[model samples]
Target: MAAAEVSHKDLETGPPTGSEKHTNGVGSKVKAHRTKDAQHGDKDLLQNVFIGAIDAGTTSSRFLILDGAGTPVAQHQIELDQSYPRPGWHEHDPQQLIDSVRECMEKATADFTSKGHDVSDIRAIGITNQRETTLVWDTETGEPLHPAIAWPDTRTQALVRELKEREGADELRELCGLPLSTYPSAVKLVWLLRNVDAVREAYEAGRLSFGTVDTWLLYHLNGGLEEKSNVTDATNASRTMFMNLHTLEYDDKLLDFFNLDRNKLRLPKIVPSSSPDAFGKVSEGSLRGVRITGCLGDQSAAMVGQKAFTPGSAKNTYGTGCFLLYNVGEEPVISKHGLLATVAYHFGRDKKPVYALEGSIAVAGSGVKFLMNNLGFVEQSHEITDLAATVEDNGGCVFVTAFSGLFAPYWIDDAKGTIFGITQHTTQGHIARATLEATCFQTKAILDAMAKDSGQPLAELAVDGGMSASDLCMQTQADIINIPVVRPAMRETTSLGAAFAAGFAVGIWKEFHELESINQKGRTVFEPDISEKKSAKMFKKWSKAVEMCRGWSDEDEDDASDQE
Candidate 1:
């Protein structure tokens, strides 16, 4: 079949309802993304059939159509505008996300068709989203109650501090494998309830629905306005403190402790990572009626794409924030260190789930953004990579890119980003090099903590994503941790992971063994080249930089004044 003819008016941006309805802003962007011409192919397309996967991330929304070989033949992506409404408060116009998804899907599908590849062959779709960004909407209208609160928002810092002062701090961590930090969704939910009048009234009226991005997108895609139901995958649900680690369900104690009504809020049904009905179908768009079969949090999805199912497989993603996940096999093991327990992926039916240990660094690529935006360093981010690659070494420099705070193993929210070991000899090139080193150092630290918690030695890591594209960064990661760092020829592993999940769910792919059967070729491995002693010395300097940044807060009085 030739590519299905889709029109701009087939769907209009309104409030989300079943299948295709979306918010007004989303419709406008779709209006803006209108393309006039596309290439037409004469030769027969490549021989294959596959599924579509949507990878919704912090900075971008991407669509990937993957074949049985796990390679994306055509992909399209669009970046969303990330807004800092206030200091330490992060938000996204939920419409931007919705429209971006539509735009990406249209472009990707258009590309495939222009190449004579038929869209009918796409069996299903998977969704992997930036986890922990909270959205509450009207179950009836499918309208977002407020701009989506990003995962890194510190508005809940005060709430977290108060909760930590309570007696149940340690117990909560033991129960949830997460500390009393503003990072978790539970505290964020509390802050929203108390501060946002719309949310409070909606909660009382029983019209409020809450979910992470995946749930919100799913609802909108499936007929949001009329048949709105909040639901999420196990991988995303694990990030919320509301869910129990063992049972993978929301805990009554957690809800009561937060003083939240169990029924007042719309809670999505928690489903397996990989299952057929686990995801719903997109009711609208060029690919309307496409089945969304797989879903995972971006990190967990990346874990799947990396094939880190067996014990010891690990990887790090460098994006707006840094996340390092290590697959730990069958059962969930609570972390002794300041690490979060997470689900790697759910391959089988309700029984025998796989688990993982994760260490999150609040800022990685965001640190680079800070350097470019705040400090006025290089013209563009790509320039930083080129400059860093210029230096043979860091020239005895160490940079702690903790502009926000440190996470995992340390959990020091009090620290600030700092540059250390700078002297007359230091240059921007060295500074750039140190910035990349800072990320690698923190990654190694989190991986170490994951090892200690899981009691499993890490094997070679498989990496993907924008940051993993850097050869210098990859080599540095290997040299610092003294392990082989593997980068896939195709770096969109997060979407690949979602596609795999959806494919498995729809029976297009039977088992992990079948997915593994793909050649999985062109993996570049960066083995340890630096001496262990040199690595240790570099770490010692990085450690001191962190210590110097400790207690970078202005004053307790400032925080108190803000509250008043």
Candidate 2:
């Protein structure tokens, strides 16, 4: 079938086409409908066909219900409780993750029904979650053996250093497209096996199951122990350091490097990001009986949501951290410039999977949070942009926001947060502006590295997430990077991407081109407002700051050693 060409107004107000029909899972024709209310006009009209997206992110769990047009009709979100028992450790209660998702689904569904919609209209559900956060569980009891080791946790930093010295350590990147770093699931899994008794005992008893956040959500959402839907998509699996980049499967050699036994430990089955039956159905909840058809890591989902299907299309998400993913087409391009190669998405079992080069920054919105919570510059994160706008410019100040350490392109593990060119004239506004510019500088670095690796210059950058909501921040990003920054009016592209995947599986939208008008209505484009030479000069000063900031943490470590 040819892709549909619907207008944004038509999609929002009425069906795509008159009497347009699509078949659901059971092969029954589902027609779009619009009923008018005497009091509310088109407000009571229902699409009658919908998709649900379960977005289990790092800080929160969100459920969004989208119509065929990709507009989020109803949604609910809940912040997750985070635990940090040690200095470099971060964890989450496994049950809280599950409960949060369930509550979101229930509440979102309630909101949908209250809008004069039917629950039966929701055909399929998709899931997108935080990548690389490791979870281990007892297979028999289906209880988590340990607290979920969060992706940002640095407890494995010492372990990573030790592993880098081991033989065959240098060869891992060629196989898995990831370096021996503290981010991947393999390192976190190894840490748990060595440090946690419950995890080790479960592993020894042949009852341990290892999974990322996506797999953990799938297992419980599909009826927990009864269904045991232990599976992960390629996008999430690619971040684990266990999955082979070429074959998209777990490698035995990679397993040997981590001293993992595939026989004893239960690994989630790897599946395509968009599949009709691979992920199984939602066994219970407000979404009970709906087939769970799509899954992707949050970044990958954002790429899909932005409709960045063409090669050379790139996106930058400014959340707690910043992730820049550049699409490299079907074949994976192993980065020679410190970027990680990852699966972009796999729509079906037969179709070839697309790949991307990813560059991650350790801090973006967190830098804003630090300014709010740590420095007391503002009452909320969004206010930082206003504070930044008070200053005409950075006033010769540069803030290297390496709260934990720099990541991607630089990978400077020993660097600490530093403010360079700070003078007595530096005010709170100057500091706030410099903090925002820190993310922009890192994004420019990653984009440069991506161009070097893929041999493709980015024409523009599509951006979303919490930090992207600020016009000043995005405008600064455009000025620094010298590229057009595109932000859609519907900023929940992560959830929309999951809905797109589920919609694809159920024939609601047959091809990517059908999504041409989905969320393209009211987009704000930030052009490069500054001169190119000025942007370059500003970046050069930032580069100098990065180099000077190195070894700051190393000096602190040395002082601690001397005291000991």
Q: After superposition, how far is residue 433 of candidate 2 from its true place, in Å?
A: 0.9
What would the per-residue lDDT of candidate 2 be over residues 1-564, giving only the tens digit for each residue?
000001111112111222244332121122332222113212223255799999888778889999877778898888788787765567899999999999999999999999998989998999888888899999999988889988877666667777899999999999989887777899989888887888888999999999999999999888888888889999999999999989999999999999999988999998889989988888787778899999989899999999999999998887777899999999998999999999999997567899999998878876876788788998866677667777788899999987667889898766778998889999998999899899999999999999899887899898888777666777679888988887777778888899888888888877787777667766666667678999999999999999999877653342211110
Off by over 4 Å in 2: 1-46, 554-564
Output the number of the TM-score-best candidate: 2
Per-residue lDDT, model 2, residue 560, is 17
TM accuracy, model 1: 0.88
Q: Please, what is the TM-score per model?
A: 0.88, 0.90
- Looking at model 2, the pairs that clash are none
lDDT tens per residue, model 1, 296-372: 89888888877777777787766777788887788777888778887778765754678888888777676666666
Model 2 TM-score (2 dp):
0.90
Candidate 2, residue 64: how far the Cα is off, in Å: 0.4
